[model samples]
Target: MIALLGCGVVLLSACGSMPVTGDIKAVDASQPGDSQVQVYAVAPRENATPDEVVDGFLESMTSDDPGFRTTRKYLTKEASRTWKPSAFTTVLSKAPNRSQRPVRDSDRSSTELTFTLTGDKVATVDAQNAYQPVAPTAFSRSLHLVRQNGSKEWRIDFVPDGLLLGQSDFKRLYRSVNKYYFATGPAADQSTLVADPVYVRNRTDPITGMDTVTQTVRSLVEGPTNWLRPVVDSRFPTGTVLRKGVTALAPDDRNVLKVPLNKKADGVGQRSCRMMASQVLYTVRDLTSARVEQVELQRSDGSSLCVLGSGQAEEFAPDGSSGAPDSQYFVDDEGHVQRIPGSNKGSGDPEPVAGPLGDGPVRMSTVGVARDEQLAAAVSQDSASLYVASVVSAGELPRPAVTSRAKKPEDRLSAPSWDGRGDLWVADRNPDDRRLLRLAGGTGEPSNVRVPDLGGARIEALRLSADGVRIALLLTEDGHTTLKIGRIERQGDPDTLQDVSVVELRKAAPQLADVTAMSWSGRSRLVVVGKEQGGVQQVRYVQVDGSAPASGVLPGANQVSSVAAADDEQLPLMADTEDDGIVKLSPGDNWQTVLKKGSSLVYPG
Candidate 1:
């Protein structure tokens, strides 16, 4: 559950617009039924006091305006011109302490309104439309307010860049929306479209729906929202635009979307064209909840260039196949990797994987496997080295794939992660060498992946999503651990990662103060262990959006050492508990020990 730093009051009107003094009512098609609409918030009154203006401005920032036009009203003309709300958005977990004090050595009328910002820095959205995580810290923003000559009204003359909002308001104002991008896979079959999750305003313009279907397409055409931009490409050209502007997108009567492109798609090949259509189809489906069956890409002349069926879109979606492996793999008492058979009903003795890594004398403290279950990466018992070897019998000793450069033995390396591209990811926890590294598959050299500014936090654990686009990291700072997500940006087929190409980190579970272990439970959900400060260790499931289901902690589990779940949400959950070795939990069922003596557990892919 999200921790509330301070109390918050709702400032916006109801979700729907209602008639004022008569029987007539306004039908708001764009109003969100599940959430409130802040687009209709009241603006600051004319000639308001400096404090009121600042408070109103903060409240107005929660409105659903596209360019923050309503929010700029509180600013002076010159200040508004210089202000760029898109530059950044600072989300606070609670309201800040506000005060206005006279600026010294300046005009007596010059007043500086200071906002003592406190509480969790939940998330930050950058000018590039990418959102990243920020650790909880107390910060301040000073707004200089002065009276305008002509109007004699006090407006903010100078202020910090970006908009600020409390956590409660942030939840009601923004929502997670996914844009589909094609993942590089077998060329013969262009399957596997990954979901690049992004947050968009929840409400849209009532008449045009710009915040709905149109926003999804526009964001997609703008390209991947994060580091995925380097690896993923869109078939849409440089200047692709929806016909009739961004607001002109809607499904047709037969559930077919007639997407009129500004540029002609005649040059795109058949396979690429279909892939383009699939991208649009999947993106639109996410908004319309599969109300759209197909997407027909059309030329400016209205001729159909290509059509993508909904069936085709499903063939390569994130959940395209049977999902991640059902069988759970873990390290046994002797440090050998063992597998528990059956999907959710596995019982009896555990079997070792068909490789030397599972049965050899090499003592592995932690392990990770590739998506295809073809290979496994293991960390030595001392956590000073990493080894990657084939899961199938190779008749060779597991070779050292990665060794930490740290001087201390305990801070050497983290458990390794394998992405869909077959690249392995790990973080060096050494305080002096706090860095993330990606190793090319099959004994390739390791390249340092840049980590975003973590506010002096050191990464303790790193888990890569199966899609290879996003990564989960457990960062420890000041004795507190945080869970964050970052995007992986790769330079175009480079032998080594360029300094400019690095994973941009963001907040995925900003509410959780201590997260020891986590695993991707589904495409967007993570099964995490650890709890709020001073709370008992229990397994809780969390979404990539920083929200958790009401299912609460896993039943019959305690002091979970590690947790593992498949990409398929329906599969049973596996975790290594303090007392129980390896336990499995089917939905709505209590935990049952599957392996009597296991340590760490994972599911291939």
Candidate 2:
């Protein structure tokens, strides 16, 4: 048996108080945020793999499973550290690995390990859950511990399931650990080759008045290769799109064009330096390729192409067209990008597609999407599911950037939206016991008993109805956040989601503070929730077409938290009265109390 020490009292001079789970208490007990979070300490050893050290450190922090403890015969004293063992292994080195919840019903769900010491505090052993851990994610975990209290005692804590790699971390981690076949493209040694391609949506924006033909390619250098695919993206108009030739043989058999590089043109001097590969046998790369943010495709003849992969935006320009964004285009047969002259910076273009489907009501702010299904909030302050409207983008990451702000604590209109298939999505702070009850009128019904992500510590304002599925969640850390809207896929439960598409809000209106109260409005327009320099809550709209945000700031609504818009109808925010009463916003300057006094307002959906 390991000796229980009274060192905690000597080490921590502060008065006795319980530290929150997963919170890192200062070893020095200084003012908060002033000290570094000590994850682990190590005595330098020879020839140890980083993973080995990480594993050893994690092993020291967990409680051994009774089954494992029996298998090993007894506990080893060499693994001793400042803290006792945890309930599970932080690393993916053993059995009982972690698994995602069958479905994600809430806005945020995370899988983590907790380490408790003999004292009052606990440490988070979540380091091994890095986005791109070398090993596949694990579900099995064990805690190794010394006999505490002489009774083989173990305190039980809940690690919410359904945690997966964060989108940003997942992007990097997966890319780092997974070996990917380079999507090959035609190799260009030095000589330039040119080709032509057609029959696709032209790479241009009608809203910002940015046309493909009007652009030119100033130069061409091969960009990064994914799965062996050649790429190019030059922000200038000329560099915007590429002309990829298609050897499309069957129009009905397949929807996309794919063409093999003419290998017949070899030995042309320019041939050695310039190489080409098989494209979809066509000039147009589909929206799948456009999912990666900052990529644009063009075809030969500069006729048609795709801008954003999942039909999202690239840069959020005040005037629509992004300047100097990560751009991609196609090369011609001679390995030369033919469209020499392109966009003149943000000289202006048409509005980009704001989001999925068409104009709807302000209530559309509360929306969620699952491949074919959608659920939205009702303005009547009741929870209900609505049929989702289908929308498509030219980009690959199909999810949309919802809004920028989180709702104030427990704000209803700021609650979650529903994906079509099965999952219920809410803000980080969603009420744990929420349910999905379907609203009448739709042919189908919303999934009940759905699981949610609940990314934030508390649920705030949430709205999702039409335009596009939008989810706005607040994070407990520094109050920063992530807003999501777009397509989703389900795994098990009716409402559990497996994957989601990232709708580049850059494709939406390029305006900050356009979102008034909620983090996201709809996929089309996000309600600006942040107050500009002044404390006034201005209501702005993002068109989703890559132009400036709509100039619709409703003055006088200082405390506006959620705003919804119907087609051509006035957008309204959940206005509050001093008495807590809620009311629909009426025309006025900033700071007007739209609701009667003492009416603690709930989100009117």
Candidate 3:
């Protein structure tokens, strides 16, 4: 074991006689680049008090110690040997407040020190490294300390099972990364990749001694998380893993990443091997500063299995778009569906679409464009019926594909949404006839979608992910609206919908008391408009797993009634505000007025 005296003495001698008078300065602890700050741990000193020992142990949890060697010195021999730091992590809003007291033994011969730790819990990271955020709640834990019969040094006999950290420390140490897997039921010619986001140590991982890039590759081979396992599949075979002693990965001069695999993956076929390589390329594309243009997989004996280029990987993009969208569509003041240029920098003149919905008898209140941009579904001005029409040429509007009989317009129908698979979704909010409906290919007969776990809540609005594997729902119960995400499960052919359902509804933004509008911003994230209890409305981005991203809050908008975003994040974010009409927010810029009067805005799904 490493001696604790070396670190303890150095720290004491450096600050033994320093002056303690200076002007106080304030610093922003939540800056974006704080992750680059390194933390060093100091071991306990000789003859330390009980409070000092407890404080030192808690501070060491935030340090960059390798395997937490110095942290174990503050614990008794038995506790040190049995402690497991990798079990889970509990994150508080700030450093926990500690208070100490004395506890008498049953025989009244000896006394032990008990310290209570209290804070507001913010989130928790499970053993699988999945993050789940919750509403702030009170937290309390206790630690017990005892000294040997003849020793003056105090050591902790009881400690928490896993690590505990504050919000700032947790942000500095961990980073979020997305791993890619193929959607379960897509055909071989139409395989689509889905993202599974998780957290890993920003620098070297203490448990595996692997860097961030290598850690991400290893996680992809391990398969998707439990909640997503029912709707996705991994091409990596069972028992596959990285070669022994491989601890780092980087792109070569030609921007190619070579991955070495164990014997379990040695027998994969050429096609399957390329698919495996695509998964690696997509997973690591955003991790490194230098772009990775290709990926080459190597076998156990140092022979190349197969190679996949970046262009080939685009064949399986989630949205299936050629590139970024060229235009964004919305309903203008005259109830016509008009479109403007999709560039983020400046605004352009808006023009009507090519179909009857753009200039017809039925006035449209909202619209949903197909992923291919060839067709659109529009809800009537009164929200009582939904119509579909071709947008590429002049044509007559089709009859209403869905209709509602609710007396009140607000309780009739919601804005329609199109998924990557060409299916349309909407909800009828009538109290007497509430149902979630889906139309196959936006032209088939509407069918009721079974939501087994919705309890008694009514759907107010809905959005489908670009990959067609997930859905976001705004649910209202007792006059309170909340955001929830559910997995989309289909039980038939890819081209046709036979049996469809949305199951396993989980809260996506538990911190917010009311959700008004939302749009899918990226593969695993959503831009939401909501407010906390007794707080003002705010716009922010949250992951599908419910964790808020670092620097996710956008510039404030007033009374945003609806919002729209493209799968490609480079496009501008559009929203309709009651006070500012229709506004667009681009990257690194403030909100700008796009139109003085508009109700709903949307991009191709």
Candidate 4:
């Protein structure tokens, strides 16, 4: 039996004279900590009233009862047989408010009671456990109850198929985990893995009776979410699934996890099997407390298919095996691109990058380093010209790869960004000829990438994800700036350049009234510098899906103009501030000044 916390029954009178007897307890819907305190539902008491039955069911939805069996006790037999909690989840800003009303029969007698649950909807978790945040809107759902034929007890006969939870309860019961998938497309490398983030129960999943690890692996085998499916692939063979009746999975004493798959994966080649094992190793690395040093794939007949160690899995790492970046780059007081060792110990004197962009005639105001750190794309001081050159060897400054004809400096080009595919992206802010352009291999002719849903908004800044499949854009319109994440779709052969466009744009930070800067901080997260309505500027980490994490907000800084973060979390976060020049915030430390006169700081994309 599970222990119940902060539960108490409240009794009241019905018509100012008759007594109402039932057990209706208020749920303590507070957010749980990292330890993940568990909550379980209570069975309904005898002779419960209609309101009591509805309240009991709603509270039970927030608990960890196995199969939600206790919750079904408050429902009619027909409803219990038909309800599907795994269909989806509706997340509200707070616990839903309930109001009761009576349903009349043809004879004008009260035959049933309907309780309406209403709140501010914040997000929705689809059947695949994919989270999608939406602008907050009003939500209302009705549950109808009736008296049983044999007993006077009230039971719910009509209820929604999915669970309704408050944001706080959702955070307490679920966690966001990234499942790995191989990148696909003309420019994508077959060996590189991309992150596909989804939500899963933090502890044991009630609906499936599976532990966290098993649930995550199940989600992985089910493939990527709808939004990301077009750009990624899974090595797991079609119709692959966990062995029948397997609910719990644990790493062995040697920290090796063995996964038993159905026959569909039994005939895969050695290379494909190893790649599949790597995907599992990467996906479960962060989900469990115990270290998973290796993963072994097993056939349906219990024979070994292949094994992959953690070190071997690094070959398919999204950011490559270069480890953390060596240095951070920025423009110095002299308008020349410079770099400093990207270490947390202490700051070092800035040095010029090896080529023309560092010492040439053209003064650069902003810079973007390629993922490999071998090349850099710099925008001229006036923001009209974008030049690309090698950062490892000295050479003459290459001609402008892209140039904007916008008359005003502020209306010219935004900062350039390089994706993991070695391609370059930048937005021209020219009002008469606004276009989002991409350079094939950072050298080919600039091509205008179509943005079908941009409407009339202007792009203030743009950052591409390391996987090259998602692009973050700070769109400004009517004096308001918002952050949006767009999906990058490419067409054509792998070797030759082709058409590229950004589509299916979604808001990444809807709560902020104005966004000044942002950078990709993790696989599916961003460090955003923005301000909410009637609020001061703040630094927070927001998931690509728009939902804020538990530890999202960072320590505050003043007058921040720009911010940068490396894919590796250990590297300190750097920012350019008007009051403090360049500053960095290391893990477990407050912001410290790195330099007193540097700007446009950034780590390799």
Off by over 4 Å in 2: 1-459, 465-470, 474-476, 479-487, 491-516, 519-523, 532-536, 542-552, 567-605
lDDT of 2: 0.26
Q: How would you encode candidate 2's per-residue C-alpha lDDT over 497-538 as one tens digit per residue?
A: 222322212212222323334433322344444443334544
Structural similarity to truth (TM-score) of each candidate: 0.74, 0.28, 0.92, 0.94
Q: How many pairs of residues collide in each model?
A: 3, 195, 0, 0
- Let me know the TM-score candidate 1 reaches against the reference structure: 0.74
Q: How many backbone clashes does candidate 3 have?
A: 0
Q: Model 3: residues >4 Å from true position, as ranges?
A: 1-33, 104-111, 186-190, 321-324, 341-346, 494-497
Ranked by TM-score, the better of candidates 3 and 4 is 4
Off by over 4 Å in 4: 1-27, 30-35, 104-109, 321-324, 343-346
Which candidate model has the greater lDDT, 1 or 3? 3
Give lDDT for model 3.
0.83
Report the C-alpha lDDT of model 1 over 130-149, residue by residue, as the tens digit.
55655577767677787777
Worst ten in a row by lDDT for model 2: 175-184
Residue pairs with backbone atoms closer than 3 Å in model 3 (clashes): none
lDDT of each: 0.69, 0.26, 0.83, 0.86
| Residue 396 lDDT, candidate 2, scale 0-100 | 24
